[model samples]
Target: MGQKLIVGISDWKIGRGDDVLVTYALGSCIGTCLYDRTTGISGLSHIMLPDSTAIIDGHTTRMKFADTALPDMLEKMKAMGAMQGAIKAKIAGGAIMFQTSNSKFNIGQRNIEAVKAALQKLRIPIIAEDTGLNYGRTMTFWAENGAVEISSTVMGKKMI
Candidate 1:
């Protein structure tokens, strides 16, 4: 199959062939990559926040927050015939963009911690990550080959 590319904020794309899911400019945000090698089905979520509790109703889009989006992404993959046990995860793009005196509103740190906590709760192991930096990032997940590439204006592109 030919290559398929997807791009945006708070978006996710799943692939079973030669498709790539990519998100750019991840600053004070996080991206999660989920892949099932056996089925060659992979997914990625670009989340801007840790939780959606303040949003109320609890019925926003499934990609809105890390706490909700991660689990939902896994479920979607499983429904598409991806085996739970075969799924591997990679995370990136949690940067403390600005130096601040107060730590309470450290969105980047909160985002990273929240993602780790959510993954732990789901019993999914994080095989790799490039987080907690002070820069922005662009992440590309090549589902066809189970490859995840990360790029930053300061760091350039590198495999994670």
Candidate 2:
């Protein structure tokens, strides 16, 4: 019932009231949403890469990579009274961005794949997804209703 707030890259938001959390312009990066219906608690993470093996230091940042951030995000949510078994997930982003000749630079695809593998490993079922495309997306998560919405210049806005 309040104004929606925009969460940028590498940002995560959690809420228990009527506020809606949103992010924009997701190309290769991934946006993940976790919601607990019973508690009306919701959280979202925007991740850039799949793994952090390439980083020199072991320190992790919110926007750095999914391999490190996803686990941390889940842990934080659990601390906020979100039940693991009761948490439902929705993911978006992972666009091709541009036609790249080199495979190493395909960060978007790698990010998406990493998120999927992580979720599977955690035994969390992904209720919905909008990934692997050629355009950027804007994603929103409503904590009050547990609804995830996605929008794009090419696809417009729709609930996922």
Candidate 3:
């Protein structure tokens, strides 16, 4: 075990070797992780919105949306000597916090869809995912083995 890198909401981080990356309290948000076992490189992102372009010039962080964050993270991983073809993904979070009839609060599902589409466009396969529900989630990614552990109030703890 190495340092525990904490990825906050709308943030991301990369780790190598024995490092562990964790994101806290994902609800109506998505947590996406990319890993290459051979290189021992891993990236994790916490996205609050589906697309960064949707906001125009509005205030937003680079790591705050699926569209921009996914590709950017991939490129960063590649720059760090991770092979694109060898990279696999594990996604968690994207929980619907609230909903009502005719409400546009489907951010959770939309976030999941956006993440899947982005990964598909990047030609990265998602090996595992634990997503979509009414409860929040906390995710941990082990850079050494590319394993993710998910925890939550409702689901207790699980490995994905």
Q: Candidates' TM-scores?
A: 0.93, 0.92, 0.96
- Residue 49 of model 3 has an lDDT of 87
- Give the per-residue lDDT digits (tens) of candidate 1, residues 1-160: 7466665677776777888888888888898998898999898888888987778785567586898888988888999999988888999988988888989768998999999999999888899999986999988888887798899888788999
Candidate 3 has a TM-score of 0.96
How many pairs in model 1 have backbone atoms within 3 A of each other, for residues 3 or more apart or on separate chains, i.e. clashes? 0
Candidate 3: misplaced stretches above 4 Å? none
Tens digits of lDDT, candidate 3, 25-135: 999899999999889999999999898876878676878989999899899999999999899999987887876665487888889999999999999999999998789
lDDT of 2 by residue, 10-91 (tens): 7777777898989888899999988888887788888888988778875657456787777887888889888889888999
* Worst lDDT 10-window in candidate 1: 1-10
Ranking by lDDT: 3, 1, 2
Q: How much lDDT does candidate 3 score? A: 0.91
Error of 2 at 67 (Å): 1.1
Local distance difference test, candidate 1: 0.86
